[model samples]
Target: MIQSLRLATALLSGLVFGVGLALSGMLDPARVRGFLDVTGAWDPTLAFVLAGAVTASGLGTALARRLRRPVLANSFDWPTRSRIDFALILGAGLFGVGWGLSGFCPGPAVAALSGRSLPVAVFVVAMLAGMAAHGAARRVLLVR
Candidate 1:
């Protein structure tokens, strides 16, 4: 069925992404931290990863624009917002700070969890808590 196919595709995509992260040393906090340390013992490996990600993203976007709809969906779901707002700025700032401090963004952190690392588990728990708190705060603000 189409639903099963979609699930399989999603699983495969996630597997590939996780494998890529592992291979790129993105799952290693030390490597990521080294990359962020621009002034001392800088590692440039992550820069190559970032460049590859950007290139893939650019190619994907271009391909999406040429298609009428996604291969497995009814239509393409793209961002509707164009304006830069306070919420966007705040969210980005928080994300950057978190990444710089922990060297683990959401995707890489989740992928790193497979190694059963205590620190990674703690980071994931904190990340989930932050997401829940953000959702709750957003709901409260919207209710006013």
Candidate 2:
């Protein structure tokens, strides 16, 4: 029952997120590319979108910390990573390159997949391959 509830909540959250992305023009690669084009016609509209997201996320996180236990889960699962490592830097750099080149990060990319564009499909495939490679590499490299 708990797992079912969690799954339902996850699906609902994804639906909400996809709707927000579509409404905010985040699902449009042209809008994202224009935002990144600071040297050219840089569109700062998405900056407001990003700021709103940060603000809402910050407030949500603050409220979550005040709770004794998660409303659905037994406890909060906060991120445990404390140290910045080489993998973190490399991954971030790669993500920026991919975003700048394709104008689609993971969330927006997945949302944009509904359009059925060949480029978007290829990007999603490449993104999944990178994620798989990262996990495999981490296991091999971290295990000594």
Candidate 3:
């Protein structure tokens, strides 16, 4: 019963996220591009969306940490790192560059693909290949 409830919650969360992306114009590459442009006709709407997400995620994580046990899992799975290191900074810079160039981050890229955009399809394929390479490299490094 707990697992079922968790599954339902996950599904609902995804649906809500998708709807929010759509409603916020995040599903549109043009809007994303406009925000990244930062010229005379710059759009800052995405910043507002990101601010809300960060605020909610921050609060939820803090609340979850105080819980005795995770609702569905036997234990909580949390990252130990509180410090930002070189790798983290570099990875974030690369991710931002990719988002700026493609005008579609992971979530929005997937959402855009559902609308049948060729550019999004190509971007998603390249993104998947990059993720696969990263996983392969991580596995090899961990084996040693």
Candidate 4:
């Protein structure tokens, strides 16, 4: 029963997220690229979307703090890391580079897959490969 509820919640949340992305023009690589172009013809749509996201996140965090546990989960799965490290910085840098170059962050890229775009498909494939490579490298490093 709980598992079904969790699955339903996840599906609903993803649908909401994908719809929001599509409506906000986030699924468009050109729009995203325009937003990233600070010195060129910049678009402020991404900023508005980001502001909305940040506000939602802040509200959710506040509500979570007031609750004993998540509504659909046993407990909160908060990040265990508190301090920034070299690996964190490197990962962030890599993520930024990929986003800037492709204009398709993970969420939007995945959502864009519904459009059946070849470029989006390529981006998703590359993103998955990068993730797999990172996992493999991490395992190797940990084993060293």
Query: Per-residue lDDT of 45-143 in model 2, one digit per residue for the tens?
Result: 999999999999999999999999998988999999988998789888998988989999999999999998999999999999999998999899899
* Candidate 4 positional error at 96, Å: 0.8
TM-score of each: 0.98, 0.95, 0.87, 0.98
Per-candidate RMSD, Å: 0.7, 1.1, 1.9, 0.7
Lowest-lDDT window of 10 residues in candidate 2? 86-95
TM-score of 1: 0.98
lDDT of 1 by residue, 5-98 (tens): 9999999999999999999999998999999999999999999999999999999999999999988899999999999999999999999889
Please report how far candidate 2 places residue 50 from its true position, in Å: 0.2
lDDT for each of the candidates?
0.96, 0.94, 0.88, 0.95
The model with the greater TM-score, 2 or 4, is 4
Model 3: CA > 4 A from native: none
> Tens-digit lDDT track for model 4 on 1-144?
999999999999999999999999999989999999999999988999999999999999999989999988889998888999999999999999999899999999999999999999999999999999999999999998
In candidate 2, stretches whose alpha carbon ends up further than 4 angstroms from where it belongs are none
What would you estimate as the lDDT of candidate 2?
A: 0.94
Model 1 scores a C-alpha lDDT of 0.96
